[model samples]
Target: MVFDRLIHPFCICSFSLTVSRTKSESGVPEVPVPADDTPEVLNKALSGLSSRWKNWWVRGILTPAMISFFFIIIYLGPMVLMMIVLCIQIKCFHEIITIGYSVYHSYHLPWFRTLSWYFLLCVNYFFYGETVTDYFFTLVQREEPLRILSKYHRFISFALYLTGFCMFVLSLVKKHYRLQFYMFGWTHVTLLIVVTQSHLIIHNLFEGMIWFIVPISCVICNDIMAYMFGFFFGRTPLIKLSPKKTWEGFIGGFFATIVFGILLSYVMSGYRFFVCPVEFNNDSNSFTVDCKPSELFQLQDYGLPPVLQSITGWTIVKLYPFQIHSIALSAFASIMGPFGGFFASGFKRAFKIKDFANTIPGHGGIMDRFDCQYLMATFVNVYIASFIRGPNPSKVIQQLLALRPDQQLHIFNSLKAHLTEKGLLPLLEEAA
Candidate 1:
């Protein structure tokens, strides 16, 4: 409350200017109508079809093109993929915040737009700073300014956020107090959803492109397969929020995704490029995907269960352990992932809007397409941390390298003693 006094009379003009920059809105928010911008030939081709059939055709045509572009981005390498992710994150934040502005337009709250963008900048700074420090340690340590920034990154982020928080409190007007706080909460929630999840996605990417590609591909596969099955075979509705979803489609999509995930994992697991964790190469001054393949990526003989062995007359099966893990990823993608979309649908219904924005013709917006993806990203990141990932030796070695020479020598001697007691030092020396 004390901070409210900081909005002196001198600041009113500039704050008013910022508020005026927000798009004009009527008292009532209008539901967005998705634009029909398909090619004329496509429209002509689909002219005879029913609306449902037309939608299916449009999505079918565009989906492959989107997938092709996705693969092109992948081929462009991780940096481009990361930049694209940031772009999407920014677009998604803009779309959600714009919707909030539309809904709260009657109050004409001050500093809403300016503070929203300011908070976006603050969160991006925090997350990207953490990422650079974690993944590019060598580069950060080489530069004095970067090392200091990395060292005090969290404090800087918190201080920057406090500045924005104080500004919001100061800009609040009496009549619009409630509405101002509502938009403030709305902005923070949007940042949590879009920026935070996309950052996890980048983390998964650094683990290995396989970790990134497989989970995303499973989600995409389930979405498309579910739609296809529901179009033809769906009978009983699955949920109230999503009218078109059906039990048949849900069941069909689950099986299809599991199979697709297994096959994809099997193919990807064999390639070092897909399985190796991304690392910064101090020598080449670049990122590298070169490393020894982990046991998870290697094929091994696994004995079948007694029932399966009896039925198939085989006792052993050769598979990548990653293929087994794929089932869990695909299961979540099929079974739990749709709930993210349902939540989004509920959010839209509450706001009396049809979609977040009409960025795509058949699809509603980037948010519409990615609602489940953000959820999936969070799950995959958790799964890797909880079950798949072990302590990274490279990270440990890097930390060791950063120590004082005496500290490094002490650690070396201690490790040598431990290894000698464990009887591994002799074996290691013999191999060397």
Candidate 2:
């Protein structure tokens, strides 16, 4: 009887321990399991499946809707496009600064919010001033009001920035100084990331809509192609930061983007609307897209490979020079662009957040969509500076016009002497 009692209690204890472990492991409340025929159990299962299906349907509809809206905005023109970018910049700044505030919530720092916004305004003024002064020189020269602003643009920008700096310094509290400085650094870094990239994006847009559109489209194409390939064939993970990305997706997207870039270059190159730089015409009193397009937009014959020529009975293929440049753009979009997304993923993971914001139904946020685009923008700007952009004679003349009469005369004399040394002054005089 003693041994039987001992065995029974031991068995009971072991069973109780197993039940407790199961409950803990599953992380479910200790509720009684329903019978196999219970209506409640069947209803719960059906509800779960229905919820999942609804989510899938919502995502399907939202993706295309967002894409259509984007295309509509792009079709509107540069001014509309710029306004959208500015809105995005503000929203992204809010999201990032909000995160910083949340992380440093315990400090309860004063004036942090105001200071952040003030800095944003300062940076925008500085960058936009440079843009207007550079691209819209003629307008600045024509308008007396803008002439004053244009002359002291940098000084005005610096003074405004200094005012923000003084405000920040004056607002620092004794105990919260560390927190305030941390937030200050946060604001500046966010500005560098968001504002600087956006400035580059505007620069690309000013170069030509093609520079802006094609690079951005290549990024979008790569992203979609990558996702489709990953969803269908992904097995091996491409990176630990993003668990869903795969090597198959990356490689497939690369090839697809190259083809897409080539085709897009062909179409955009034919149109003066896409290839022409945005410029304000003094004669027309409005912006004009009419211009003789660069040679890159013009067609050139490229010799085909022997095997391809043999198969197609053609030795040469005609294509825009810009198409060759597109390969580089597409390649960067394929290779380095995804790293921008990866960096964002890692950033979100660091903060234990899914996305920067929930602005879009399925796409997380504007920042999420634009992470790669920002990187692509920087690349395009750098590419244009290194390979495409040249000194603008018109801008030079405008700068000379803005000078004092004596200064203008001195420049004119210097130019005439230089032309005479090159034996071009006689030709210029004869033509005149």
Candidate 3:
């Protein structure tokens, strides 16, 4: 009798949970399709083709168009790229939150949507504020209001977040407490995934447009090559999460992206505008992308190993050092980047959805397209920190400028003493 009582309630709970999942709507929710959308036009144009061929044509047509738009944004400058990143971040957050709402039927919950958006705003303010303080320290110090905010940025961000937390607590009802907390957690995870990665992307951009452009272009290249190879020669499945992915496509994409990255890096390394870090010109009160090229961007002769030198009949080859780094970036994009898409695929499977949204014709949602890009962004940021970046002179000078006069003099004296000990001070005096 005791065991029966325990199992009876457990069975009821399990049955109820299963029922809820069954009732959850799936497959792109009930978004009303507009008659004049690009997908519709393409569908009509290729009505005579089979569905497989139709998808191929649609994706091929839209893919290059999207690449052209991306390059155009790059030409417009870094500011435009940052803005586009923000817009895409917002859209991705919305798509994920919408999925949570539909799956949980949480739309009726008070302050759910409002709190989600509020948290997004709070997070953005914190990140962008930090970016301003880091990259535009002069501007921040010049403006009193900005200086105050920069000083108290973290405290202000915490207070804003605490306010939202209290609102969520107050909004919770007797029976809806669990559901509200679930949504709260959902919102934070989405923020971590979308907002944080996008912030790192902007950081990479400030490092140099090459850092930003090369990794992203590699991911785009791998994605395209993978699909083309799969469509023509896919036989063995790559992963259960995405049935369309195949071993053949994966290998083909890897080699293609590496070559593409190397060529692209070599070409861009020659241009100062592409290779220089983005910086604010205090005199002109504008952004500048002009600097003497670093050794990484300069062409250097690399001798081949004895075995390879004999086989190829070449002693040494000239290449930008950045091109070697591109091999690492491209390798990651081709190998590990697909895991991000696989994760998204699993998330969709859990919700029984075909796509996140119908926002992009032939592609799924903006999130669908960016799933791998976010992962790639994170890797490139880490790679730069670990292997590529050195202590930034501009940032060091900015920090020194922020110090008190006495502290600044102390640093100057300390630096002179250290250089004097190294026998470098007399050379500096001679140069002066």
Candidate 4:
């Protein structure tokens, strides 16, 4: 009977009151109890939740594989990569337009979106776009490849963007608002994708992949340091823009990046890693191997001077591979990268959302993935432009400057010479 009474909810309440009264009557203060087995019940519930969180990453192999696939599309260099990003940009643009309109209350017109490529292209020229011919000559000295690639990219990207816009418009006509919004979001997406891809192509064309590697390495180091520290030592909030961020984590992570920069500069550059590596030589002929200079670079033969020795190892063996080449240069990207991330975070928060699409499971959406990268690319591009002008631009200025001296006389003589040699100038004179 006691056991049955203890099991009943109402009976338990009654029994608790009787116990409290008995204790009070006996001159003892009543001890408070929350309910029957409250602590144990809460503990069990918490345990179950913890288990789920601990094992959350035990997904199938496709999860990691899908992640790798996406990574390749972004970093695998031009050719196919340009196309992949074009598609992504179109998708992102649609998302942006939709999110702007319904959620963030941003205004955008249908016609503007439909003609966004042409619109932006015109604006691009005004902002800084130039003759693709001149732009390439400025970078590579020879503009042939650059010129061909430029025309090719312009035609393809514009066509694809226009096609996407038409699709969006058609979806609206068919009453498919779901896809209509998607197509709209795609335009913004395409902007980021195309911009990043183009920057990479240009980077490879100018200083080769080496110039671009700095941004990639630095971003990787920064992100890794931030996440590792945040996961382990996060306490105080780092910024209002991002609630989950921590000051301790950010500081710790940044310090780690500094260390990585220094370490890479020394280790990867083939310079001193504590003590610089000594050179060894083996000449094919009679040699002064013992008299060889103590240096980092190896000689082709045992007798060759260390200074004249062939570089036998990685080229950047003397400086930190991760160090920023230009301090004032990287500052823009450094500042912009975090700002971009904060903006994206703010966007997601505004919509009362957690993650974006869960494409990476742990990482969030494609926008989340690209937030920092997009800003970084833009910043770097601007930095390069500020420092380096194209050959065509340089040559054009040179040509115009040279014309100021004896300009008409030089042209008249050149025309006379051409007519004397080719006879075209005389034929034109006879016709006139």
RMSD per candidate (Å) reads 6.7, 10.8, 3.5, 19.2
Instruction: Please provide TM-scores, in order, for all candidate models, with all chains considered together.
Output: 0.88, 0.85, 0.92, 0.48
Instruction: Give lDDT: candidate 1, residue 317.
Output: 93
Query: Model 4, range 6-83, lDDT digits (tens) per residue?
Result: 678865544443323322322322322213222344445446555334323322223456547745753554324435
Clash count list over all predictions: 0, 0, 0, 28
Which residue segments of model 2 deviate by more than 4 Å?
Answer: 1-59, 310-312, 402-404, 417-432
Q: Give me the runs in candidate 1 sitting further than 4 Å from their true place.
A: 1-35, 39-41, 394-413, 425-432
Estimate the TM-score for candidate 3. 0.92
Stretches of candidate 3 off by over 4 Å are: 1-38, 394-405
- Where does candidate 2 have its weakest 10-residue lDDT segment? 25-34
Worst ten-residue run, lDDT, model 1? 19-28
Model 1 pairs in collision: none
- Give lDDT tens digits, candidate 1, residues 301-393: 999999999999999999999999999999999999999999999998776677898787678789999999999999999999999888877
Give a tens-digit lDDT track for model 2, residues 46-70: 5656644544455566668777987
Candidate 2 to truth, TM: 0.85
* CA RMSD (A), model 1: 6.7
TM-score order, best first, reads: 3, 1, 2, 4
**Model 3, 84-176: lDDT tens per residue?**
999999999999998887765623789888999999999999999888888888788888999899889999999999999999989987656
lDDT of 2 at 94: 86
lDDT score, candidate 4, position 8: 80
